[model samples]
Target: MTTSTTGGRTTVADTQNPPGATGGRGRSARKRRAILDAAREVFLRGGYLGTNMDEIAALSEVSKQTVYKHFGSKEALFVEIVTSMTSGAGDTVHDQLPQPARGDDLAQYLREYAYRQLTVVLTPDLMRLRRLVIGEVPRFPELARVLHEGGPARAMRSMAALFERLADEGRLTVDDPRTAASHFNWLVMAEPVNRAMLLGDEAIPSPQELRRHAADGVRVFLAAYGPGAGHAPR
Candidate 1:
């Protein structure tokens, strides 16, 4: 599969089979996965401008023509790398977020949710990819947009849905789930993510530290949106 971004929208192409295709579909898929894996490593080690198709092909153990046959250009491969990684991370966080249940400890649920999101997103590769995309914003602005939409925006939407459910259960006094979700998201993410991004991977918080941050963020969120908090719509 290959991806293209247009006007901040990403569309994937099914390039597993093309006209007069020679190899079997299984072989093509393996090559595609190999290329993506190799490209991801290369791009993360070296930013977009520094990466080359020849290096990627060599690492993947495929011919240069095979690399081009799978992903038309270096830019396309890079875009695919960004989209795949971000989307995969988003999916992991979304899928693992705990569902709010009646009589459930909302604070614990939210903390687990927040901590899961933080751990998934604060990985070395994802952080490096974020930095690389930011540096290339002027050249590949759409890539940055795609990264945000796929990672943060998607997470916010999932969070909004959870908040809406809590409100319906009278567990939260949310007036606007989206707004409440935004607050909860940045409350949990901003400090840790910024620290890691600016200060390097070594600056990433330990599990105990991240758990404390998640707990603190949940406390603040509940103060504003918890039952009887009287959080009015802005």
Candidate 2:
């Protein structure tokens, strides 16, 4: 579960200065890319409050003046990193779990979906991002809202929509699809994810372990919502 697949860097290259511009537009683009990449590493290591523009500039091999020219301020760069990371997670999860109209074999579908979600959330990079956001929340509370909307909220909506379709087809007895979706997603994630967040990535469940967790969650979900269970919201 590496964060290699999502949007790691966004280069605000100059369109006015073409790739072959004599004003060093090409150099500007390279420097911008370097600064962003360096910022990511530095921020991840030192966090938002601890990171400094000078450190980023030194790591990026650009002058501090150049770093300021590209990003303006440390807060602006940190904001981009967080927004891109969370937004990337949301977009990636939706792609993996497309809200289907309906499907058969309840346990299998849920197990697969759970595994996918687990995999994405348990990534080391995402886990670190979670820690960063939580640490930043006390001072920058709006960041928490951004994180929820970009990650968990988006994933839950996708799951809830799927549940609604399942209910419509009489495959599940869902009264509140959104709640059911949360229950299912959390069922598969709570223990392992909590362990990872609290105890570090080494505590994160292995692939086989995640499969078992997903399977167990699917079983519980089916017991409660499967067609003939009469399992109602309590």
Candidate 3:
């Protein structure tokens, strides 16, 4: 048995499960999921230093010992939370990417792609997470790195891959798929993401607004990259 205090109450857990026990593994996985969910809420609400393990344990319905057993320390838990959240979001965006078929309308595909990216990334939760990570960078530089690698960097990679395929099919003329991906990404994301980040959730755009922005971005991207554009001077 393991005992710990949470919110001035004593909480206990059965710790005697033998190694390689299936039930034990299932229970451990459940506890870990609960801890991550609860910790994300607490950290988002309170920031890093303000958050407490006791609160997380209480909210998660687990003993504080279990939280520590799973995550070791508050710092470790924080890193895991940031990494998990960003990676999950990145995976979602990557998985939902539209499969570009030959002869599909490039402008329509680009607009849909841009709009989808915006919709996935411009939510209140993700925006708040981004701000939170940015604020903590001085103390936890790795958090920023994780956010960038899992979010924008991952998105750019996916975009570049699709662009490469399109260019191969003669739909676009791309000297550098990576650079073109960056241009299209920022063109769709920069204004809206910056607005939401700096001005708060109220600045997040509506679907109609996002659609308009996506259309405009696709137009510019096609002007420079669409077939017959011929690479457009670097």
Collision pairs in model 1: none
Between candidates 2 and 3, the lDDT winner? 3
Worst 10 residues of 1 by lDDT: 14-23
User: After superposition, which runs of candidate 1 have C-alpha atoms over 4 Å from their true positions?
Assistant: 1-23
Q: Provide the clash count, candidate 1.
A: 0
Clashing pairs in 3: none
Candidate lDDT scores, in order, read 0.90, 0.83, 0.90
Q: What clash pairs does model 2 have?
A: none
Total clashing pairs for each candidate:
0, 0, 0
Write the number of the candidate with greater TM-score, choosing between 1 and 2.
1
Each candidate: RMSD: 7.1, 7.8, 9.0
lDDT of 3 by residue, 151-215 (tens): 88988998899888888888889889999999988999999999999999999999999999999
Q: Lowest summed lDDT over 10 consecutive residues: which window, candidate 3?
A: 11-20
Sort order, lDDT high to low: 1, 3, 2
